[model samples]
Target: MMLLRYLSQIGKYFLMWKEIFNKQTKWPVMKNLIYKEIDDLIIGSLGIVAFISFFVGGVVSIQTALNLNNPLIPKYLIGFATRQSVILEFAPTFISIIMAGKMGSFITSSIGTMRVTEQIDALEVMGVNSLNYLVFPKIIALLLYPFLIGISMFLGILGGWMAAVYGGFTSSIEFINGAQMEFNPFHITYAFIKTLIFAMLLATIPSFHGYYMKGGALEVGKASTVSFVWTSVTIILINYIITHMLLGS
Candidate 1:
């Protein structure tokens, strides 16, 4: 039964993607979904991303500075490392994890609550496709989140540079120079791609768990827990796959 449920969830995910592509069939639904997702990304997620990025940038800079005692290590390399870390790993992975905790739980609980309350049944009676209506918006919103997160990460890198300079870890000139040196555009673009994939998984998995929720409040709680755990685990696993395939060890 458990295995079947998992497989069924996977099937639902594919169906959701198919709906996204078949625009003529789902145009009105897609429009609504896109709006909902935009709200989730822009209004709901913006503050948290900003907060996390700022601290992560500062902490990473400090740690990197502490580890580098040798004069051979360029001072500006700290900034470079900060940028690379924020752009490549921190922004995408951390944001996904945070969203898994926040948005994922919301998706699970909202859907589960609707099921427990029989609102989902009302939607079915009204001829509304619950999956397309409820789930698709979340998926679309998450697709936009990573780009916003990428912007947050860029700001965080600037914050880190400011912090490092304040702490005398590196001069302002050296920090700027090192950051510009050896910079590659592919790094940022690749991170965005990885983020898009992660966001989809993060958004969809929780919605899938919540959509089929049975029982009452306790079951709703269980679904929320499962959503968080599974989404976080999946994000980590996918991160590894993308990193190994693209960045490589």
Candidate 2:
């Protein structure tokens, strides 16, 4: 009986997602929600992403160089490996993980706070479709965040190049050549698509959990923690699925 009830609830939530996408009801107030989420994701994440990406590139370059000693492995393969790893895997995956920590926690806490404070209730009383007004904007904002992170990832590659040259892992020209040789437009596209899907799940799931939070302040904290854990797990699982299904490697 309990399992049946749980299945029924899942069905209802699925329908809610369908309804949201279908625009069965108007939700003009999603604009503010979108902006709020953008501020939290894009604007708020800038500094941390910049710092992390720069170091990540540097570390990856250094490590890759340390691992290769065979003449059979061309020195330029470092660049190829770096480019592929950064674009298709490291950049997108790591950035999403960071975002799950930063933006995910923010969404959970904010929404949970609103729930605890009755602000969500107030919005309800005002005839706002809380889901549409709150959730939609966040979803849109997170979708955009991944593209920004993609750009950041590119810059990070450049940072890695600089670090590699300075650290004597590879010459500047060799690094650039490796990157160019490995460049694949399809891989870049795949990364972007994956990031977008990740962003959607990252934003929506946390916000959903937070929005319905009950109890009190402590419960809000719990929701935030759960949001981070679930978002990270979902991101990793989804990334594997997409990588195998779409990229076929």
Candidate 3:
């Protein structure tokens, strides 16, 4: 029964997805909406992402330096590990999980509130495809998500470098060598791919929860929480699948 219910929900979600591109909102209106969404979703998120990436990257560096207490081990490994950790997982995957809380909750609650207040119904009555008007802009705005993740990668490496140098863990020169050593360009590609997929999940999953939620004002809050959970879980699952496919040998 539960499985059947889940299957039904999945079907409904896809139906909404299909409708998002139909009965398109006019470009003039949609242009403004898209800009608003980009400001709300992408530009609004930069400060937090940058701050977290910087500190977390530093922490990763510090931890790696502490662990390599052996004279036999090269100090450069600290930089190498920090670079790998930040690029491969921390910047792309972990930061995305964080956004699943921040952005996901906002999307869900905003939409759920609209539902509760009958604003969505009013849109339908006015002949607007609310789904397309609401969700498509978010989807389009989040196409810039990879750019955000790219900034995260750069900040993370920069943070790691600063932490290692200032903490007396390694000389800047040695750390640079390690970071530059055997660098695979593919890792960046992999991270961006994961980021792009996660971006879609972040946009859609929370919108789903908000759009379809039933009940009154209280349900909006509940829907937001649920959306965050589902969004985060989906991101982690997809991260695993993408990693397995792309990096697993």
Candidate 4:
């Protein structure tokens, strides 16, 4: 029974995906909508993302420093580990999971509210492609999601440097050298690829839950919670798969 329910929901989600591009909204309207979404979803999220990235990066560096009890171990490893952690996983995967809660709930509640108020029905009656109007802009806006991950990467490394140097774990020069040492450009490519994929999931999955949810105001909140759980789970699953395919031997 549970399996059937899950499969049915998956089918519905794909159907919504198809409908998003059908009878597309006009370019001018869509352009404005895209701008609105970019403001609401992307620009609005910058502060929290920056704060979390900086603090977490510092934590990563401090933890690495503390774990090295052996005097023989190089202090530079602190920066190396922090750089690898932030660029490879913390910025992309961890921050995405955070967004699954912040942005995901916002999308779900906003759309679910529209559904409850008959706004979506009204749109349909007016021959408007509500899915395209609502969901497509979000998808387009999130194309810049990689930009957030880029900021996160920079701030995270910066935080690590500050924490390590101020905490006396390592000198600034040594830590910078470690951060630069053996840095593979591909790691960044991999992170942004994951960011792009996660961005798609972030935009679509919440919209799915909200668009299809039943009942009234209460159900909107319920759908938001379920959407968050599912989005986070899906992100984690995809992260594992991407990492395995890209890095696993």
Candidate 5:
């Protein structure tokens, strides 16, 4: 029933990936597309990611401080909590959900439009593997997605520090010490692992939606919305599964 439909979709998605690499588009052409996508997908999204992430981190710190009403709680706990939340969850998972809306919609609508306009058909008729030409470049471009997440992690902590100090929740010394205290590089590794997984999802899921979409402009819009929802859900579910697998006790 519904379960089978989902399972079938999953199978088809993997099969598309297999075909995507079967014989890639020419290096020169793919290289240009890859560079363009890097600009569009990675460089283009930096501003929004930085702005939202900074504020969110600050809010997390302020909330943590406010909740610790008891005098017994050390002020540095604000920094500690913010670090754990941002590095482990906020930057990697929540930010990815946001991108699933922004980038996923773009991918879906762009491809869906091409589908509607018969551009994909023309490519197929010319013996070109449209999926590979269209999607592999996006996948290659998103490999740099970890770098974006890295920036988010740094800015998030910096914003938390600023908010906590300016808001009188803690002194600069206390916050700095707390942020560096008990630091585990493994947490960063975990975050980057999740970022890489998310990058693949970002490229593929939306491409799948757009590539398989039918009909005209109206359907493209519908596909974009549907792609965003499914992409977000898939990301959250995978975040849980990967976290449990990697960090579970």
Candidate 6:
């Protein structure tokens, strides 16, 4: 029964996707919507992203430094480990999960409210492709998600350096050298790939909950909560799958 229910949902979701891009929106309207969404979703999220990333990076560095008590372990390893953690996993995947909370709730509640208010029905009555109008702009805006993640990576590394130097864990030169050593451009590529996938999921999953929700004001809150949980789960699962496929399990 559960499997069947999920299959039905999958089919319905695909149907939604099918309608999301059938007719192009007017260029002027779309342009304005896209810009607004970019400001709302991307630029609006910058402060929290920077705050968490910097502190988390510092914590990672501190923990790495403390764990390497052995004399044989080089001090520069603190920076190196922090770099790997921040770039490969923390900045991209974990931060995305955080966004799932903020952005997902907004998407679900807004859409769910529209659903409850019969706004969507009115759109359909008017022959408007509401999903395309509402959700596509969000998806388009999040195409810049990789850019956000890139900023996270830089701030994370900077935070690590600050913590390491201030905490007297390592010399600045040593940390810089270690971070530079054996730097692989492919890591950035992998991170961006994950960011892009997560971006799509971000735009759609919450919209799904809100769009399909069948209830009143109270239910919109419920839908938002459900959307956040499901979005987080989907992201974690996809992260694991992508990691296994790309880097081998």
The residue-by-residue lDDT of candidate 1 on 88-171, one tens digit each, is 888888878888998899889988999999998997788777777777777667767766776777878987897899988999
Q: Give the TM-score of candidate 1.
A: 0.89
Q: How close is every model to the real structure, measured as TM-score?
A: 0.89, 0.90, 0.99, 0.99, 0.98, 0.98
How would the candidate models be sorted by TM-score, starting from the highest?
4, 3, 5, 6, 2, 1
Q: Can you list the residue pairs that collide in candidate 2?
A: none
Better of 3 and 5 by TM-score: 3
Q: Please, what are the lDDT tens digits per residue for candidate 2 over residues 154-197?
A: 77787778778888877888888888894779988888888888
Q: Which candidate is the best by lDDT?
A: 4
Q: Write the per-residue lDDT of candidate 6 for residues 1-249, one digit (tens) a residue.
A: 999998998798889888889886788999999999999999999999999999999999999999999989999898899999999999999999999999899889989999999999998888888999889999999999999999999999999999999999999998888788788998888899999999999999999999999979999999999899989999999999999888774
How big is the positional error of residue 123 in model 2, measured in Å on the Cα after superposition? 1.4
> lDDT (CA) for every model shown?
0.82, 0.80, 0.95, 0.97, 0.94, 0.93
* Residue lDDT tens for model 5, 1-249: 999999999999999999999777889998999999999999999999999989999999999999999999898888899999999999999999999998899999999999999999999999999999999999999999999999999899989999999999999999988898899999999999999999999999999999999899999999999999999999999999999998995
Sort by lDDT, top down from the best: 4, 3, 5, 6, 1, 2
lDDT of 3 by residue, 157-208 (tens): 9999999999999999989999998999999999999999999999999999
Q: Better model by TM-score, 4 or 5?
A: 4
Q: Model 3: clashing residue pairs?
A: none
In Å, residue 33's CA in model 3 sits off its true spot by 0.3
48, model 5: CA deviation in Å? 0.3
lDDT score for candidate 6 against the true structure: 0.93
lDDT of 4 at 80: 95
